[model samples]
Target: MILHTTEVTPLSGYRLLLRFNNGAAGEVDLSNELDGEVFEPLRDPVLFATASQHPVMRTAAWSNGADLAPEFLLDLMRVQQGDRAA
Candidate 1:
């Protein structure tokens, strides 16, 4: 099944609370993932708080055009939740 982000809420320390279309919801910390040119800008708390669910992509995105795939986010969420199989 293809996963798609249905909602996203930015939290402190570069974390995000996400809800997927499949009924899975959790918080994923992205503090360590902010690297490279595209993700660099999100290092700033202000910009990071701009995270929202993209209309078309159906994934987390920021005004700077930076976005993460839903599948990636779901995997990270699972890992953070201690689902080693993720």
Candidate 2:
């Protein structure tokens, strides 16, 4: 089944606590992902903390337009917990 992001809370150091539609949630560190022009603005902790769920429900993004796909976020959670994605 496809999943969607229900909530997003920005954590310290470019990390985010994301809750999904399926009741799955986790912390995602995006410090390394902030390299390109679009993502560069998010490198600032303050700017990164502006993350919010988009109306489409598929992901979360910052004011500068840097966003993460919910599927990718879920996969990261699966890998971190050693649980395979269904």
Candidate 3:
């Protein structure tokens, strides 16, 4: 998923205000989700020290090294958003 943070605003607690390129803006509460390995590094103050240090873009490749369809990206985005795209 492409997480382009246009503006980041600190909430009352550990939540963050995220504005995506699709114009779907929402607050992702990460207070409890930060315990996982993928998000554990985000707790470090150094990662945020550099604005250029962002998550790497990983393209979805098929078994034959072929690029996945555009629908796949959309499906992934929906899954990440806690929705099952039918």
Candidate 4:
């Protein structure tokens, strides 16, 4: 089954609350995830907190044009919850 993000809310300091369509939710700290050129703009607090879910994409994206893949987010959640992906 393909996973899609239902919603994303900015928490603090590169952390975000993510809700998935599969009823799984997690708080993800993106501090370590942010890297390279595409994520440079997100270093700004205001931009980091601008996480929004794209209706069409159904993924979280920021005003700086940075976005996180659903697969990556799901894996992170799985690890955080101490559950390995099957």
Candidate 5:
């Protein structure tokens, strides 16, 4: 099944509250994932707060053109929630 992000709210400590098309929602911390150029800009709190659901991609995106796949986000969320099967 294809998963699409429905909403995204940025939180402190580089975390995000995300809702998916499958009716799953959770907070995922991305503090350790901001490494490469695309994600590095998100280290800035202001930019990180710019996270939102991309109109076309239907996934979390920032003004810097950085976007994460909904599937990846869901997997991350599951992992954070201790769902090892993810």
Candidate 6:
């Protein structure tokens, strides 16, 4: 999941538009999944947008003192697959 540009549009929930280096794109909805301090900063749209521009996006913040993980993306991907399945 090597991405080129990741544009995150925060809707009613947190939605991410991931554009991969290979031209593949996917979206991740992180509404119900995150409801803790790790997501608190993201409540601020500006901070969230800036974080999304980082190399690893939210994961980096989560890694450095923030309470979250890179696995969040995998979970989101699973949710995406589930949506496609249904």
Top model by lDDT, which number? Answer: 1
Choose 3 or 4, whichever is better by lDDT: 4
- lDDT digits (tens) for residues 42-74 of candidate 3: 454444222221233232222222222323444
Kindly report which residue stretches of model 5 are placed more than 4 angstroms away from their true locations once superposed. 84-86
Q: Quantify how close model 1 is to the true structure by its C-alpha RMSD in Å.
A: 2.1
Report the poorest 10 consecutive residues by lDDT, candidate 5. 77-86
TM-score of each: 0.93, 0.83, 0.40, 0.88, 0.93, 0.48
TM-score between candidate 1 and the true structure: 0.93
Which 10-residue span in candidate 6 carries the lowest summed lDDT? Answer: 58-67
Cα error, residue 20 of model 6, in Å, equals: 6.8
Model 1 ranges with Cα > 4 A deviation: 84-86
Error of 5 at 21 (Å): 0.5
Clashes of each: 0, 0, 0, 0, 0, 0
Instruction: State the displacement of the C-alpha of residue 34, model 1, in Å, after optimal TM-score superposition.
Output: 0.2
Better of 4 and 6 by TM-score: 4
**Compared with the true structure, what per-residue lDDT tens digits does model 1 show for residues 1-86?**
77899899999999999999888898999998999999999999999999999998899999999999998998988988986322
Give a tens-digit lDDT track for model 4, residues 4-85: 8988999887888888888888787788878899987787889888899978788889887778888889888788668633
- Stronger candidate by lDDT (1 vs 6): 1
Candidate 6, residue 35: the lDDT equals 62
Candidate 2 lDDT, tens digit per residue, 1-86? Answer: 78899888888978888888898877877777788888888877789889988887568888887787898888876776676433
Once all C-alphas are superposed, what RMSD does model 6 give against the true structure?
5.1
Write down the lDDT of every candidate, Cα atoms only: 0.91, 0.80, 0.40, 0.83, 0.90, 0.48
Comparing candidate 1 with candidate 6, which one achieves the higher TM-score?
1
- Kindly provide the TM-score of model 6 when superposed on the true structure, using C-alpha atoms: 0.48
**lDDT of candidate 5 over 1-86, digit per residue (tens):** 67898889999999999998888888999998899989999999999999999999899999999999988888888888897322
Candidate 6 clash pair list: none
